[model samples]
Target: MNTILIIANLLVLFTFIIHTFGGDKNLKAIEPEQDSPKRLRIFWTMSRGAFHIVSIDFLFATIGLALINFTDYFQESKLLLNLLALYFLGYGIAFLLTLIISKKFSNIYFKMWQWLLMLVIAGLIYWGNS
Candidate 1:
């Protein structure tokens, strides 16, 4: 059994839970008012859709990791594991680049700590595949 992969799977599962439930309040806050312009409303709708799509992605990743760790189904699929790792690494890089471009260094770590979790998860996945 790949212990590192198992841990990564657990983390991904936890991330999915938090992102789905814990982010609800924040998501609601961004909702456009009924009286808002059509473009604003449309943007909000698209944003919300994108947000939920990420949650779904995380859910799928969690399931994928679980299958890889607990079953022989994906045991030999190193390329799949690498793809997952790259996906997460890209997410982390996106967050980091956003933070850098924002020029808000006051609270560097707390500003976008999600990047750290993403990078760690990516590293664990890659390491486990090896």
Candidate 2:
């Protein structure tokens, strides 16, 4: 469990760094069309990848919290955990589809909404683990 928490934190931190710093120069260079098919696909793929990576942390955090909240209700938490896990699975699918087909959602760390969500999820992860 400790290992899982640490891994989650690392992933979140790494993602934050990349999302924050990785594309600044590029963003300035590219005058992306907001609604173009190519741009939209790139946006989706990027957003999806970021989402699932953060979801890993959320998944672990929720599991950790569920464990702490109700030790005897492990079975119940298992269902919740399984559901969260499935979201991550679906995230991967959507992410990959965007990468392969749409090419817009790829590496999506642009929108302020997504960045804020990542931060919120990180906080949730910390609370869940703690």
Winning model by TM-score:
1
TM-score on alpha carbons, each prediction: 0.90, 0.38
| RMSD after Cα superposition, model 2 | 10.3
List candidate 1 stretches off by more than 4 Å. Answer: 103-105
lDDT of 1 at 129: 92
**85 in model 1: Cα distance from truth in Å?**
1.0
Give lDDT per model, in order.
0.90, 0.50
Error of 2 at 69 (Å): 13
